[model samples]
Target: MHQQLPPEQLDRLICLEARIHKKSKEEIIQEQFLQIESEKQTDENDRNKQNMDSNKKSDDLKCSQNSENSPQKLFTSQNLSPVQKKSIITKKHSQQKKKKKTKEGQQKDITQYLQYQKKQQKAKKCEQKLMEYSIQDSPFKNKSPLPSDPALEKQLKEKQNQIAISEIKIKELETHNSELRETISSLTEQQLRIQDVVKQFAIENEKLKKQQLQVQLQTNRVRLGEYVVQREKTALVDVWIDGQELREAKEQSKRLEVLKAEYENKKKNSKNKEEQEMRTLNVKLNFLIKEEQQLQETVDRLETEKNLHIKQLKRVYEEEHARFTKNNDYPLIGERYQVLSLLGKGGFSEVYKAYDLQELREVACKIHQLNSNWSDHAKQNYIRHAIRENRVHKELNHPHIVKLYDSVEIDKSSFCTVLELCDGPDLAYYIKKYKCFPEKEAKLLVGQIISAIKYLNNHKNKIIHYDLKPQNILFHLNELKISDFGLCKVLEDDNSKLQLTSQGVGTYWYLPPECFHMGDQPPNISSKVDIWSIGVIFFEMLFGQKPFGQGVSQEKILKEQIIVKSQSVTFPQKPIISNECKEFIRGCLAYNQVDRLDVHQASNHPYFQKKLN
Candidate 1:
C-alpha cells in the first residue's frame, strides 16, 4: 500500500522546492509527479512508498539544476490549465500493466537521474577514504601494507584520481559561471547610469542651443536696423549732392560729422584715462590704509611706554617721600602739631595723622593749600570758604558725628583744620568687604545714620550733609560716625528752606531729582536731598548695588535723567527684604521733594519703628 503525504507537509515541501528551483509551484509539483513515476519503474521490487520518498529527493535535485541552468526560460513558461495539471498529478495505477515500449522509455528516463546521484555519492566516499588512507600511510610515519594486488591497487587509484579531477572541474566551472553573472550585472548597472547622464546632458545641450539661437536673432535684428540707418543716411547724402544749391550744406554736414567723430574718440580716450586714474587712486588708498595701520601700531607702543614710565615715576616719588618723612620732622603745622604719616587725600585738601603738642593726643589734620596760579581775589574767596566750613563743622556735637578740635593757619598759603581721629576704615570698606549685610545688621547701621541726620536737621541747626555717602560714614571701634562737612549746607530758618548752591556740588548718584533741575532759577536744595541719598545708601547696603543708575556713568545719568525720571525704586529678588522696608525706601526715593519723607518722618517709618517696639 502507498502512503500519501499530509496536505500541509506537501504544500510546504512544494513551496520550498519552487523557491530552490526559482520556478512556479505548479511546475515544481509537475516535476515531482514525473519523478515519482520514473522511480516506480526503476525500483519495481521496492515498496511503492520508497518510490514517493525517492521522488521528493529527485525533484529537489532536478529543481536545483533547472534553477542554475535556464532560470529565466522556466520563469517565462506557459501556465497549465487546472484540469490538465490535476490529471497530470493525480493519475494513479492500481497494478496496471505497461506496454514494452513504455516500460523501456521510463527505464531510460530514470537511468541518468539514478546514475548521476550514484556517481556523486561514489565520488564523495572515494575522496573521504583516500584522505584517511593517505593520512594513515603517510611517508612521515610507518607505511600500512596493501590488502590487494598491485594491479588492483593501481586501478582503484586511477578511479579515485578521476573522481577528484571531475570534482575540481565542476567547482571551477561553477566559480567561473558565478563570476560571469556578477560581471554582467555590474556592467548592466553601469550602462543604466551612463544612459541617465547622457539624457541629462542632451537636455542641457538643447537649452544652450536655444539660447545661442536667441542671441543670433537679436544680433541680426540689430544689424538690420544699422543697415537701414546707413542706407537712409547715404540716400540723404546722395540727394544733397544731386542738388547744386545744397552742395555747401552737404559739405557743412560732412564737416559736422567729422567733428562729431573726433569728439567721440576724445570721449572714449577720456573714459580710459579716468579708469586709469581710478586704478591709481585705489592703489594709493591701499597704501594709505597700510600707513594708518602702521601709525596705530606705533601709537599703541608709545602709549604703553608712557604708562610704564608714569608708574615708575610714581613708585620713585612714593619711596622718596617715605624716606623724607622718616628722616625729618618737617611737617609741624602751626609749630604745635607733629605730622606722623598721610591718612588720606582729597581734591582740595590732604588729611594727615598728627600728634597735638598741647593736648598730646592723636588727631587728623585737614590742610588746604592756596594754588600759586590763583589771583588775589580767588585766594580771598577760598579763605572765606575755608572759614565757613570750619564754623559749620565746629558746631556739630553728637555720638555719631566726628568732633572738631581746632583750626590753624600753617603758612601764608596753607590752612589746616584738626579733628578727632577715627582709627578704623570707612563704611565703604565694610560694604566692599561684605557684598551686603543682612536685614537686621543693615537696619542697625541705617538707624545710626538717620539719627545723625535728624540732629543736623533740627530747628537749632538746619544743616544738611550734602556730600553724604558710604565714604563719609566712618567706623571708630565699630561705632558709626558721619564725617566730611565740606559740602554741607546751612539753612538760616526753622522752616528748613531750600538753599541754592552749585549744581555739581555733591555726588550725582546720591543727589535728589531737584538738584539736577536746570532753568532760569537754580534748583532748591533742602534736608530732603539727604533723604534721597540715604535711600540710595540703604538700598546699596541691602542689595550690593545702587537702586537707580547703578552702573551708568555720571554724564549719562544727567543726560538721560536716570534719577529724575525714576517713578519708583525696584527691589532686588535676592536678600528677601520685607514689604515694610521696601515701602520705607520708596518713601525716601520719591521723585518729588514734597512727596519724599523728611529726616523726622523717615526716622519714624515702620521699618525703624519696629525696632523701637
Candidate 2:
C-alpha cells in the first residue's frame, strides 16, 4: 500500500508533514488532496458530458469485437494500447452496453436468415429442374421464338435485312477476334515472366493477415470505451463529493475555532468591563460613606442638613436594582440569547433564554447555580452536581453528550453549568406533537440513543444515570441524548462498584421494578438500572405510554397493574409494526432485570431491523 501511492501524492504528504511541524493544522490532506483535485477535474468533465447525454452527443465509439479470429479496428489516434480503457467518468452512468444478441434472439435471427437464403436457393433449384424437364419433354422448346404476329410479310423483309446485317457483323467480329488472339498470345508470354512478382505479392498479403490476427489476439475483447468512460466519471463524482465534503468540513472547523477564540475574548472583555464599573461604583460609595462619617461626627450640629440627600440616594438604588432584575431573563447570558425566548421550567432548575456564548453561535444554556430559594440540602446537592457535571462533560467526547463551554463556581454555594442548547424538542413533547414516528426512523433514533448509552457503559468510571426518562432525554436533530446529569453518579474508577437506592429519585414512571421494591433489599444494581430506564423510554417511544398507567387511583396505578402484569401495554391497531420491532419492545419491558436486554446485545437486536445503521 505504501509503495502504491503515485509520486505526486507522496510529495503532498511530505509538504503536509512539514506544515504540521510548523503548527498549522489546516492544510490539504496529504494522502488524498492530489488525488481528489486530479479526480475533481476529470469528474467535472464527465459531468459536462453526462449533461449533454440528453442531446445524444456522447462519444459514438463503442465496443466492436467478438471472435478471436476476427480482428477489428483499434483507434491508434489515442494510442490506448493498454488492455483496460480509461475515461473522465464518475457515478454509475456508464455507457449502456449495446444489447447484444441474447442466446434466444441470436438463434431466432440465424434461423430466419437461413430460411430466407434457403427459399432463394430452392427457387433456383426449381428453375433448373424445370429447364431440365422441358429439354427432356420437347427438343424444339429451346430452338427459337414463334413467329406469332401479323408480321408474316414483314418477317420475310426482316429476314433479308437481318441476313445482310449478320453477314457484315460476322465479318467484323472475325477480324477483331483474330487480332485479339495474337495479343493474348503475346500477353501469355509476358505473364510467364511475372510469375515471381505475383508470388511475392501473395506473400505480403499473407503477412498482413497474420498481423491482423495478432492484433486481434491482443485487443479483440470488446472494448466499451464510452461505457467505461461513464463509469470512471461516476466513480470520480463519488470521490469529488467526498472531497468537497472534506474541504467544507475543514473550513467549518477553522471557522469554529476562530469563533470560539472570538467568543472567549468577548467574554473576557465583558467581565473586565463589568469589574471596572463595579470598582468605580465601589469607590464612589466609599467616598460617600467617608463623607457621611465625617458629617455624622458633626451631625448634632447639622443633623437636618444631610437628611434630604440620603433619602434621594436610597430611592435611586432601589429603582436601579428592580430595573436590572426585571430585564435580565437569563442566568447564562454573556452577549448572546436576546431572542428564541424561554422554553420551559424546572423545580430547582429554570430553563432560560441564555445563549451558548461559545464559539460564534448561541444555543440554550441550562444554568444550574445556587440561589436564595434553594435550601441547604439543595445547595449541597447543586454543588456536588455542578462539580460532577463539569467533570463528566469535560472528560466525554461524543456527539450525544451536550458540550460544556466553561464551568464557574460563583461565591460559596453558587455554580453555573454552561451547555449547548439543542434544536429539537424533548421526546415526550415530540410524541405529543407527532403521535408516532415513521417505523424505520423511530428505530434509527432508538439505535443511536442506545449506542450512546452503550458508549457510556463501557467508558471508564461508568456513568450511573440515577435519572433516566423521556423528559431528561432531548431529541437533538438525529441523536436521542441522555441529558441533565444532576442526579447522575460516576462510579469509582478502579472500584466501579455502584450503590443503587430504593429511595426512588429519577422519573417514577421509567424506574425499574427492582428499584421500586427495594424496601428491605440490600444495595441496588449497577448502571444496569439506567438500562431499564432506557428500556422504559424505548417502550414509550414505540407504544406511546408508560408500562403501567390505567387507574385513576395512585396506588391502583402503581401496584395493582405494571409489576405483576406487564402485558397491559398495547399499541394502536391500525399502525404497522414489524414482528421484529415488537419483540424488542417486549424484551425491554421485562419486569425482571435478569430477563432484560443488556446494552451490548440490545443495540444489534434484530428488532432494530438492521435499520439503525
Q: Top lDDT: which candidate number?
A: 1
Lowest lDDT block of 10, candidate 1: 237-246
Q: After superposition, how far is residue 295 of candidate 2 from its true place, in Å?
A: 80
Kindly list the per-residue Cα lDDT of model 2 for residues 1-613, writing each as its tens digit. Answer: 1233334554455467768676321233333345544655776687788688844532433423332223344444345644434443322334322111232343343344445547877999778667866677577545554666668757876897799899999999999999899999988767644543443443455457546744642231221101112256447431111223233444555555555565455555656567766566556556555554554444322222222223323333343343222464222233323222344546455443343222434455554547777788978876776677778877776787766666645345444455667777677766644445777777777777777777777788877666777777786776777677777777776544455653545556666666555455556566666767766676666655555552234455465545545543465664667778777776776667677777777877776646533
Give every collision pair in model 1. none
- Give one digit per residue, the lDDT tens place, for model 1 in 9-29: 555666787898898665765
Q: Which stretches of candidate 1 lie over 4 Å from their true place?
A: 1-330
- Pairs of residues at least 3 apart in sequence or in different chains that clash in candidate 2: 89-232, 89-233, 89-234, 90-232, 90-233, 90-234, 90-235, 91-234, 91-235, 95-227
- Candidate 2 Cα misplacement greater than 4 A, ranges: 1-327, 330-340, 356-358, 371-378, 410-413, 493-497, 550-574
* TM-score of every candidate relative to the true structure: 0.47, 0.43
Write down the TM-score for model 1: 0.47
The lDDT, on a scale of 0 to 1, for candidate 1 is 0.72
